[model samples]
Target: MSPGPRLPRRTLLKASAALALPWLLGRCGLPENEEGLRLDPDGILDLPEGFRYRILERRGDRMSDGFRVPGQPDGMGCFAGPPGSNTLVLMRNHELEPGQDSLSPYTQDQGRPAQAYRPADNSPGGVSRVVVDATSFERVSSNLVLVGSSRNCAGGASPWGWLTCEESVTEGHGYVFLCDPLADSLQDAVRIPALGKMNHEAAVVDPTSFIAYLTEDRSDGCFYRFVPESPGERLGLESRGRLQALRIEAEPRRDMNAGVEPGATFRADWVDLPRPGAEDDSLRAQGAARGAALFRRGEGLFFHEGSVYFCATTGGPESGGQIWRYTPEGLQGGMLQLLAQSRDRGVLDMPDNLCVAPWGDVVMAEDGADPRWPDEHLRILTPSGQVKNLARNAMGGGELAGVCLSPDGRALFVNMQGDGMTLVITGPFQQYTGTGL
Candidate 1:
């Protein structure tokens, strides 16, 4: 059968009438409680009034492929299945590392396949595909799609498939792997080494330029972009690319983590990294020496409209977090803007994975470390500079990750990483009037 029609990428700047009006008010005040988050009686997740959640999949559950659901779920993406059908496909990441409990679909007793990235290593850090019925919110099936990797922390979605990245630099690891979510069986894993080998966090692609932007989870990480040798070509077995790091045109080696105010705009350029996948793991250091700007703990990234939005999980003067916007200016380079910074833990504490809501606002998942962080929330940043609570975690401070909305915007899907649970939230989401930035 032919593949389903692909879902159109959501625009980053498109806002609904409801959100556009309130945004015009400009942070004057928050909306009433009737439209605010409501407490959850289950003591797990608290959402706004009229909103409810259902656990779609839990770790340890036996999947259709006979393998148990892996733990430590991280980044994910939603895709449309068979054309004009309610079928939806979700590619989820399992953030497992070496020496951890074995959750891999393959067991040593079962004998590893020669195609595995590291057959000798048992820790199963990879991606899984979950098929669901969007109309009824029923799970059709779940199965392991990619395996035999390490610490598959977070990744992004492309026009063609899911891009899963490793968070380790272990010789054969620390590379990005692409997985087709609609496939019936696991395909041979292929690593895109040209994307650089570091503590990979997340990535997003600009469909127009076929340029992929990636983030590294290191404290001194440098933002990077991969320019494929053949622009707009499907990145596969025959593809080769050039990796480059970001640099501020005026302040080449500026420390973006310090002394930068909101709304500060910087002209940016790319510095070519002659050796991205070097075994020495000196990608960041080499790029820095070549005038690339540095970021503190680069984390989640998403592409919307013509710009790329990303977060620095442990940035800001207070060591809270920061969100930045980069808009490409064609061949003239691009512009980077600091959209928001966490000045206090109450506002946004260690923001992690993020996504653009259907209404155009940015929704962030908090990875706060405080003991009281369980009360941390999924924060929404309005275009008018107002930050408001969208949902709160009542489940013992499990860092929220992989926040994405269904293609039709009827349901919002997110993961509670610590508990290895995926949730589907539905309700009066459209009533939200916060103007998106």
Candidate 2:
């Protein structure tokens, strides 16, 4: 395979034009100022162009409730509610194994999910809902939504209007649960098993169809789709339907045995994942078994305009992280196509949570193990596949997980698991008309 495109210094200079103009004009304007800020083509945090970043909420900031921000916060979504009352829901994935670092929100009230029915000690997982002051851009009311799981990773919002945070694994009660933001019933967290049980990372639901798409977070992780046979069934209740995985029948030997990098383009023939609670011993090989061959080490998935977008956390000798686009109208009538692969472009050093901007732009969060990438960072790629950094960890280099744009497209809510605080990026983020945002 051909080597992916490299990020050259000249291209970086071209991409930085928006930031360079103000710096150049400052020399000629009033007093000599070295700092002047402006919005770049890449969707970075908007500030006073000249004024530098001021960290508002750090890892150990004390909250009004006396509970501090927890361990590395991951996948989060920002919803635009009433004026001055924006709700920011975050999934703080406690990336703990059997024995590792302790999870966050140290107090008793902060320890468990807002409601935990299937309880367990020494293991707790959940999400936090924080109110963001739209005008002042402050962190307001934040609380836990789920609890008592492990390695909770990136999840997605449902067609039914609740956030589904996926547990990276499914041992114990590490299952996918629906979080009804408006529910005041105080019901214990409800886990949806029809979605299949494994190492899950995120979920994408088709509002029109209510079919929930899911991604697994392991190297052998499987990609699944829970198709509600009813298509309009209510959540929580199990529906009669099938969970199918993608199997490459034509190139089983090549695809099953081809342990190198995937083909230049991603093309998967759909197969079926056995219904959960079935016999584990299979009759076929790993490659020919019922599964999703779209990509290995799957991480995040989002659905848009009849197409599914996903990211592969790892796979390949050199191409560890990649983003693949699967459109139903492909070779198999309903197949997966590699519309764009970060490995092909050398952009995604390590990609995690994903979201689509209002303008059809794909925003990816970087969850790199090694600090930050020189050119690879939280990025925005256009439909044409041109990629640019939206935000780099020049300020902080933690695995940037769970990224979502506000419904109004005003701000981008991001999580740096290692950083511990759900950072909100909004300011004079205006498009600046002619000035830029």
Candidate 3:
């Protein structure tokens, strides 16, 4: 069966309708269309100077192992090995199934459905590598990395190295796996069960402390963080760790208990009530729950300037899809800031995942929207709560998922989820931001 229809590459920007949502639209002012740049009905996805995109190794791009890379591609990450050794390790979530839809040996089984993420089974949906040149934006490597991971969505890198690909399926076996693209074969894939058993979207690690802040893609899913009892020496497997929830301002809720590392926990470890719906079994219940026991479908996460920031596809009780911030000085003290409320930001248009830029701006990808909207876009928000239209989706009709600006703050890499391709953006980063604020 075909996947969800591709959202139009360009759609009209949803001018904020409410007086209360400037924090969502962000600091940048919306620029009226001019200069004749291409945009779709969704009003999203714009490419910058000295840059253009093409279909790289597409879905059927034959791998060394011989199975065609099928299924809808989702979350991805890129690493620059040495200079210009652009090897991109992408966790392409297949959203696959059994029967003819299954890959290889699973097809021979006849009736039994395959596990979503057992790589040893060599399933079709999971993580893969795409080596490219940073300078030229050309794909160099031609191998698919990990295979059986179910619904491998957006994942981030640990400061040391390696990528954590998240399995976004609640049932039928879901997990989070580590991938090292530079290596010849995949090894040491960490399956941290304490992180919860919901449909996970992505995770961010604090290299300074080695805590994993993760989000679930389900509507009522809960947000989580795994605190390494023995901190991993930066971007690696720690000697020990425990998964905890994000305790909000209303943390001391009457319902749940406290975390094991509450006093010692450096990151937020108390989970609040998600929504009334979050009580579903998807949550990997462990430490006593607190605050909002549910979540609004957490997506992506990043740690910057001593603060851990993440996104929820669906917002909270009052909001729908919000970008939240949490700062903790260990279990001693912390605060969860609502930050920018999206219902007021460009009609929300349905945000998926997000990344941070050099100017300390949070860039978000708007993927899901109603049929009425004609364009989709990658948005940016400053810490001060300002939003701007960074790029318009012009990959014909692709959902821009993962986004990142190079370390030197040069080129920006964006993944087109609908088409399974990565594009690079360069030029003025600040001049592009604006705010209704």
Candidate 4:
């Protein structure tokens, strides 16, 4: 099938305006240089004055490949479209576990794909690809690109494709899988076991070193990286590599959950692990026993400007959240800094997925730990250690996931996980984000 035609810029604007009207007044009490988030009348996402959003895709929506869009959309990575095409491709994860057939990518008649991993168990977790026009921001096409993984959570964009992580340690389930953003059909579920196999949350390949940094979703999880004997071997990450965990050079087994203050830096180094694909879930334990530093719960991971930034949900003094930065000195040594930590749940809670915006600041999606207050938000952490509100889940309650941006930096894409909605937010992004982070 052919891709959708791109809509004219004026036409797209007119259509968007008809869907969402301007908020005459109100402010989020933001910084003087930033605009306040206007309450969304649609009660979905509240954005700043000039920003508007388009619901690009949702659960149960039929795709170009005949399969239905799965629910629980989690992590996402944006890629430049094929060759000279004026579009961006989104490789998005659906975090469905077994027995979620109702929210699976397939219908009763459709069933699981022949290439699905763990077909008997019918694990309904995978990644989908969506093409959007760069100018209009309308979806050109959508399809399932990877299937049969469990709890496909947050992942990072790599030069070759998307590094989707499965946040599950069930039998034969937890591993990172690569998905091509440009593939129009379901691809084979090839697991990169060398990346490790225990509650994998996210993975990001360093463009400079081609070494992949990974995050685990355990309370005692260890930050890991897989160094391929040969960099840029493409998808051959599982082929002859050393899987290692991060260790504090000065302090061994430093527990980050004790709450490290923002801006505190430490010398960091990597310690090689015994077996990344061990039958039991002992990878973190092995690393911990070997003097590797421990994080609360590693979630989203992003590499920007020579530094790797990752979120630790349920971390910090109050177990609110923590964001850490690992700046690689070489491939083996680096400096680890506590970039930000939430002391109050009301301000910034359980930062899950994050990406460095084109103009600099880090955009974060909160998976709030407070069950009493279900409101989650999308926040921006500036380079100077200031955290500001950017958007909120006006849709009642749902953790914002898959926070990413178009290559041209014109649109920001994120997923309302519980609501299973993918939104494209467009506005004067650069005007508010050039501060650098």
Candidate 5:
């Protein structure tokens, strides 16, 4: 079947009246007949008239460490390079499996690292580091940082390091691993079992509480939070913690896939899991037995302004998508709100990864619900519940993933997973980002 129609390029200006969301239009200060996406001459990506993208890294490209760039670039995080430096560090993940040896970064002669997790097997998924000059927007160096993990899909950045989560449970590889961006060579493979062993999609740490929030990528997944024994530890992932699942205060075992209003709010509580580090794939079931709330494939988590924003790839009545917000009130309780959900696939289809804009808007990476029509896009969801396209994948090679903005918000980095391409788009970002919200 054919997919949904594409949203009009001129829709952003009229959103205030059409959706009655004046808060977004008033704060954005966008002018009429501007900020519309124009087709790229190369037919790879379409962006606004003033915006342009630069191909930073791609599959098969050789790195400084003498290994070719791996395929299936998924989730990524951008960090400041170093003190008194004008460069930025990017940790990119490759979602490869054991049999995909052709896409491995290591050659046959080199083999895998001695400290790799399950070194006997041939798991090629890991994280790679790329350094770029912030001023010039040029790549400085690229190399492998972590190795031997399976399906390092989507992860989040923390002050300690990048929390790269494995999206697989086979061979005991469904745990989160922290990778230091400053490490030039491959680091030892260490898993944080305290974070729970399940099909992890992404993770983020609350700066104030030092508690980590994680998402599971299964249809029956449950949202989780980890409270470390030592909250002040620099590298808190290794510390032992109590893992708990979210539960609705009013209703127990609430299914969040459908029948949720756009602005619905709920008092949220947590239930502790006796065994977070389980050998089998039973963490979700364990949470369910204890009255934990359920989600439809939870993915892509970001902590912004004291709230955690996450997405459910296949939620809503039409299975389009859903974006949720969780604000931790204290160590014991929080408020959960259904910020926005897609009723039409054309407007917001399968939002996989997302990041908040510098000016307080939510930016999303669209993984289209249907593969037949490959018009995936990088979309923006306003606080007032309006959606608009920021960029379109004209190439139709893959779904957009790893949507992140630099610390300075001058550059936006995204990846095309199936095509194995990473790009940085730069333009007049300040036009929409007014003086803070």
Candidate 6:
């Protein structure tokens, strides 16, 4: 009959500060790999000492709805079920294109809907929902939620529901769609063109401010934010708002691809764009003309404590990756800091989707492609700036995506993009010590 305890803002802020201290000290303790990675007998994944994983959903498994599981799972969010229930509702995105007919529900004979967002095209990209019993790690049901989109790459979870974004800029595509994980049918999916049309990757919203920050996954990308006219109202609908791009103060059109020193803070402002839904894919170009700072492939985005953290997958001089933190100053300004950059492939390679762990660590999924290290990894970046491998891909070199934690922090869920598998890892998560900040 009572609600769960909530983390106070002050406590979260303190925890964030503690996590940043290690970076400020300029001395991150090396990752603890004493036991090394335990080879997985299943030949799927390699984990550290006390961790193990289960294959919750595979590419072609039959779902509770009689439809086969879609392939190329990307961004995902976990929502706690009704009060006191151990169930969790997960909305997962599929980075499928038009030709992946065999793996999509739309292309399947029996599960095809009467209509889709794009009724004529029959694009195989959309979102799927899965209900799981957290305590047992058993899947309750899986069904199609959104349909007829292209490359549903990465999306963000909102206090209200799920915001799935398309990573395509085709004339009729490249929009954000809001899906209710609780919805029983596809009729509820609504396209939110107000979020702007571009190569969208993922998004995160500030609960307190009601402001949504998005990432664009292009070689030349611009960091963006959507300020809804009314906070907490249905975004893109009743909460119509202005879409803007971030610009570094006194550094017009600065190319962040060269990388910046860690802890280097830059005053930043948002530049308003007149037409966010332009079909020409010139949104970033228009923002660039107005001095918007450009990033090299912006990917994962998350709002934590009082700051927004995101990754530029191929941003550094080495073309490895970069993570940046943006702390809002007030209504019109903010302070941007280069949190970390990958100078070597061994340390961090092409960081992709990331999430703030329940225990205050930043869990990053590496999408790196280096022949030297044939496999990819699930890396943990402690507040103290130390990076450690938590899990490695034994299933070839498929890039990991959709790294999120269960509501209770007991289960960590992730996806192997290339293999079309969703994995749930459970372990002595709280006992592991991160590099002290």
All candidates: TM-score = 0.89, 0.74, 0.74, 0.90, 0.91, 0.91
Candidate 3 residues 252-368, lDDT tens each?
Answer: 322211221111122244643233123244354432344434556677777776677677665633333666667766753465555554433334556777776656667888775
Identify the runs in model 6 with alpha carbons over 4 angstroms from their true place: 1-22, 30-35, 106-108, 237-239, 435-437
Ranking of all predicted structures according to TM-score, beginning with the best and ending with the worst:
6, 5, 4, 1, 2, 3
- C-alpha lDDT of all candidate models, in order: 0.77, 0.53, 0.53, 0.81, 0.81, 0.80
Model 4 alpha-carbon drift over 4 Å, by segment: 1-35, 433-437
Ten-residue segment with the worst summed lDDT in candidate 6?
7-16
lDDT ranking, best first: 5, 4, 6, 1, 3, 2
| Residues 174-238 of candidate 6: C-alpha lDDT, one tens digit per residue | 98888887865565458887888899998878899989999999999999999988888877544
Q: What is the C-alpha RMSD of each candidate to the true structure, in Å?
A: 7.4, 8.7, 8.0, 9.4, 4.3, 7.0
Q: Considering lDDT, which of the candidate structures 1 and 2 is the better prediction for this target? A: 1
TM-score of 5: 0.91
| C-alpha lDDT (0 to 100) for residue 279 of candidate 5 | 74
Better of 4 and 6 by lDDT: 4
Give the per-residue lDDT of model 5 (tens digit) for 1-437: 12224443322221221121223322222222214777687878888767889999989898998877899899999988887888999999999889998888876678677767787767889999999998977899999988889999999977688999999999768989989988877788657888888999999898888899999999999999989888867653467878999999888899998577665778999999978878798988989999999999999999888889899999888788888888888899888877677665655678999998766667889887575445888877665544556788878636899999998888999998888889999987656433243
In model 2, how large is the Cα lDDT of residue 379? 65
Worst 10 residues of 3 by lDDT: 255-264
Query: Over the full model, what C-alpha lDDT does candidate 3 score relative to the true structure?
Result: 0.53
> Which of the two, 2 or 3, has more TM-score?
2
Candidate that beats the other on TM-score, 1 or 3, i.e. the better one:
1
